[model samples]
Target: MFDSVLVAVFTYNEENKISEVLEKMCKKFKNILVVDNNSQDNTLKRISNYPVKCIHHKYNLGKSNSMKTALDYARINNFEYLAFIDGDGQHSISDLEKICNKILDIKNGLVIGFREDLTNLNLKKRIGTKILNKIFTLLYKKKISDIQCGLRVFNISEKSIKWESSGLQHYFADAEITCNAIKNGCQISQIPIQTITSDKFKGMNILQGLYLLIMIVVWRVF
Candidate 1:
């Protein structure tokens, strides 16, 4: 096991699934941080029983803000590594064990989890991801299969490497941040990971996906 690592989960009304996610993460990482965006449900109460560090935001601050809070916590606590995962139980916790060693080897790069399956995902999401892969390749000259995957590992000491995006920009923050880190002389690698399709999670609903696409176009143009 590594010396110190913090696993962060961004939650917004994920009461139905947060408990399992937290339990799995706590088993491996020990220090789990939950950044709740004022969830109305018992997500907070359910998570309270676990030894998790809770950062409550009175309003919905978007995913990037949640991530920013996670980074801040990691940096402040002197945690060597920061791992990001979904609070909706889509990512397999066992994958963490398999990739931890590989991540440690990279040392100065971001370790991204590339999901094994995409055929079950929504067609629009698949198309959007394909477009993003093409755009990232053209812009950053890198081949990344799972650019938007939530399961990723990074070293907090490499803060200067990536940009903490804001607003709807968070939808593509994973790609942007990784590219930014690459441009800043940091290496990035992909590791094979398992994925689950859970309808209960409810992230980036159909409407939000459309909105995010519009934002991407606007951002890309100027």
Candidate 2:
């Protein structure tokens, strides 16, 4: 078990999937934190069946706030690293295992998982990912294949790479955290994970993609 690490699973109306996800997560992580964004279903009840720490929000506060809550919990409890994964079951627990291993192997490091192929992604998500990746490379001088992959692990004690974790970034937290980590000189390692099937594309809309495009530049400037 990873005693120094806290594996956080973010949930938002994922009752249909949480049981299986939590079942797998509980086996890998001793300290599992479920940040439920006021799921309107039985996600919490399923979570209770597992040996995990659950924090139910009064209302849905978006992914960024959920991330902030997890990070705060890790710091307060003196965990050295914070790992985040989604509860949709799209992200593989095996990939998360690699991330946890990679983070522990390096000092002050952040491991971001990249999908090995993009052919399965829908047109909007596939194209938007390429455009944002190009823009991120231009601004940050780094070519990260997948900046928005949900499965990742990072050192929580390293303050410089922390960046600003609070905002209205409904779906931009992954990219924001990645760009900010690179901008602040955090050690980053990207692992190739199996590309998700098209059926798993949950929130990559035109508006969210546009907002992430703007935020990519915003994080670079301020």
Candidate 3:
């Protein structure tokens, strides 16, 4: 079992689903951390009874910042691996276990849970993800099935610890992380996962997608 792996869930006002997600995570992983992005709801209260570490931000920072917090925590605690899953009830605990097992087997690399079913997403999101995935594949010269899958496992080596992303450009943070990992010569692998679709977990709008495209181009240029 991957006992030393720290499971991190980055949440933002997910009072309705956070409790169930935490309960499932705690069942499989002994160490779990919840990084709350200054939620206004009773999210914190709902998770109070759970035996997990909680980091409440002063403001509603985006997912990138929340992940940075979790990464720092993992480093300080000397955890061997860091597993990140969205606070929304989309990601499956069984998939999480598969990711952890992949990390253990590989010993080093980024293991991403690639959602095979994309029929649930709207047409715009589906197109955007397809284009982004193709772009990433060409840029990194690696087959990246999903550029924005939130469920992932990373080996906490010194070299893999360094990551940078803008709080303003949160939409592409997942892509940025994957790009950095590939650029640094880390092995990237994918495991099939089933996602629970919800309207609450929909992708960005047209303007956000355009901005993300520009940011990705800029990221690749530099």
The best candidate in terms of lDDT: 2
Per-residue CA lDDT of model 2 for 1-222, tens digit only, reads: 888889999998888888988888778889999999999888888889998999988988888789889988998999999999988887888888888888888957789999888888878878888898888889999888888887889888776555454446667778878887888888889998877562455686888688778878888998
TM-score of each candidate structure, all chains considered together: 0.87, 0.94, 0.94
Each prediction's Cα RMSD? Answer: 2.7, 1.6, 1.5
Ranking by TM-score: 3, 2, 1
Q: Which stretches of candidate 1 lie over 4 Å from their true place?
A: 200-222
- Tens-place lDDT per residue, model 3, 44-141, is 99879799999999998888898899989999999989999988888989999999999989888889988788898778878888887887677768
Each model's C-alpha lDDT?
0.75, 0.84, 0.83
Report the Cα lDDT for residue 188, model 1.
79
Q: Give the Å error, residue 133, model 3.
A: 0.6
Local distance difference test, candidate 1: 0.75
Candidate 3 wrong stretches, greater than 4 Å: 158-161
